[model samples]
Target: MIDQAKQLREKMLQKSSKKPSRQTRVIAVTSGKGGVGKSNFALNFALSLTEQKKKVLIFDVDLGFANIDVLLGRSPEESIATLLDKDLSIWDIIEEGPKGLQFISGGTGFDEMFRLDETKMNKFFHEMSQLQGSVDYIILDTGAGLSYENMRFILAADDVILVTTPEPTSITDAYSVVKMVQAKDPNVHMALVVNQCTSDNEARATAENFKHVTAKFLNKEIGLLGSIPHDAIVPSAVKRQVPFVLAYPNSQAAHAMKKLAHGYLKLPVPYKLGLKGFLLKILFK
Candidate 1:
């Protein structure tokens, strides 16, 4: 048994070290509804990836409600707004957090996002693509619901991780978002993260429920990433502006996030840069 455990550990470590073939695995963290801990999940998820020694960037694309900075207990010196004005590179706005994770704040509102004309839109994509080569993963914390901005980022990501609690409303909202995204692009790859569940069984049930509804109505497959149990340690860590994964590495929630990071390790690296590749580098830099 000891030898087997050693071999398993070695295998896991080997898998984690294998670099993703893609420039970056762009993942959009979205929820069916607000208050499901979507932003917190996004922050901690990125931090967890960093703990695994993977280079990660958190794009706080929540627009007006961006709080990734707050989650990390830092005030932003710059934001997506600076990028829009061509005043700073994406690197300029990136703030280092616990575990050496980097994060960029989303702008303050939809009006600025909507105001992006063809020139600025082109510039924005260019800068976004540039970061692809420098990071292993880019996690976008999108605002709740199925707005045009949310759909845009969801479709652009290499994968989408939908977060929801066991609440009926959260499930419904998650289902609705999935339906909307599918309607726009049927082939979108999506996964689920069940947060605030009391038990693993409850988390699995929530994931199963989402899978069934999505398959029945949208004929889409939704992957189950993992779950985080309801733990006071999470909020307690939040109060300190430290990621639970780092603030309390031995905590249950931290362990679950580590498991989720391991699960992410098994996924195939996304290699294609697409049209946004060159554009993102230029504008963001």
Candidate 2:
């Protein structure tokens, strides 16, 4: 059994490493508002994907708040701020996370970097372009909102995973993001994950309602990326400064996150994004 598992691991690694492309698969995980557990989802989701042998990188681009490093019990000295100001390579700011997961911290205290002009954006993109060929996926965890920054990242990503809770306001705000994505880039692949639900039925009902409203009002079709239950283990894991997926691997949220990671891989990858194209998408008009 041990030998078979080892072989399977080797096989997955070989397949993941062989995924050559013009650009990495960029997926931005965002939300309409905060306090929806977006940060936790992003960190665990990336790590879970890594478990499947996918080379994963998290670009923590949240302007107002940054939580990934804190959640992992590590602090990064440098962040995207360094890239915006200094002549730093993408590699210079990347901090290593658990199990080879590479991440770039957000602009925590540097408010100026958040309001970047075209010149600053161009330079930032130029630096980010250097990471074009390095990984299988580049996941952006943007700040929760319909802010200009969030929208830019949302549209730029090849896939947008919008996180929301089961609350009415949360669902309403999430649909607002969907409307914006549709207006900006109707063709952008969009998915919704109902977080902090208590049961599968609740999650599904919320997802269905959101999908129905979006299809009816906005005429947009959004994929349901599955739901994460309101697991007690989540808060415990958070307090311990570890991912729930790692701390309680068999817990409800952990299982849900793993399944979500698997669903992410099943997404269709028709082509990869080139460096220039990637920058253009992020720096959209």
Candidate 3:
């Protein structure tokens, strides 16, 4: 019986090895504190990527205060809880958002995710694995702070996008979050996105201040991805349940988000579907 069990394990390992791996650009959008427009950034960033014709999946992992669905003006028929109940698959829970983007809403109740057991963990991983080959990017909209569940998702992602505003409290909290994460994972790739800045110079200064502090204290390098200016059009669009990028493409915030998308994702200016088409043809075979 021991020999038979060993043989079965070997076969399982071989089968798993043969399963093709999908190239997914997983990005976690996290902030040090709440009310810094983290969800807004996540929603707009996914939309910007979808405009480039990339298949993006935005996962609303903000357990306590889930708002991605509200931001998209969507009421999903199913959610992560539905999937956990085995009544729906990952694909079944995905709701189509603006610009053809897909999203998975977080659980509606205020249940702590850290209570998940090994069996539930396995099930969740299997559900996420189903996203393989179907999505080009998976944006994890994590809750603010360094909760155990939040850090777990942040560490699992390929990159972490730290969101912050010009407020003193926001900046300080942002630094604290980064410091905590670095203590756990020294080589984690981090990118900074400054939001609610008054002007280009203000954004640059805020990012520089963060870079300076991190380098001096933690001896770590934080890449400044880009910034979004404080534009009234964003809140106005939100009130109407529309993403600013789609609602007011000519707005300053919209244009800045597009530029930030191009810079962060390393896509060419005037980002178009042609870039993704070219990449898929050359790299996805």
Q: Pick the candidate with the highest TM-score.
A: 2
Residue-wise C-alpha lDDT for candidate 2, range 1-285, written one tens digit per residue = 335434534543455456545357788899987899999999999999999987788988887787788889988777888767766656667776788788888765545654578888878877777666667788888888888878877776777789999999888888888888888777877889999998899999998999899999998887789889999999899999998889999998999999988987887845545445656766655
lDDT of 3 by residue, 183-261 (tens): 9877667889999999989989999999999999988888689999999998998898888898999999999999998
Please state the error at residue 75 of candidate 2 in Å: 1.2
Q: What TM-score does structure 2 among the candidates reach?
A: 0.87
Would you give me the overall lDDT of model 2?
A: 0.80
Each model's lDDT comes to 0.77, 0.80, 0.76
- Sort every candidate by lDDT, greatest first: 2, 1, 3
Task: Encode model 1's per-residue lDDT on 1-285: one tens digit a residue.
Answer: 335434533443354456434356678899879989988899888888887888788888886578788778898766777778855555556666676687778766433665577777766665655555467788889889987767777777777899999999999999999889887778677889999999999999989888988899889988789999999998898899887888888989999998998888887745444335423422332
Top candidate on lDDT is 2
Which candidate, 1 or 2, has the higher lDDT? 2
Task: Give each model a TM-score.
Answer: 0.85, 0.87, 0.84
Q: Give RMSD to native, each candidate.
A: 8.9, 6.3, 10.2
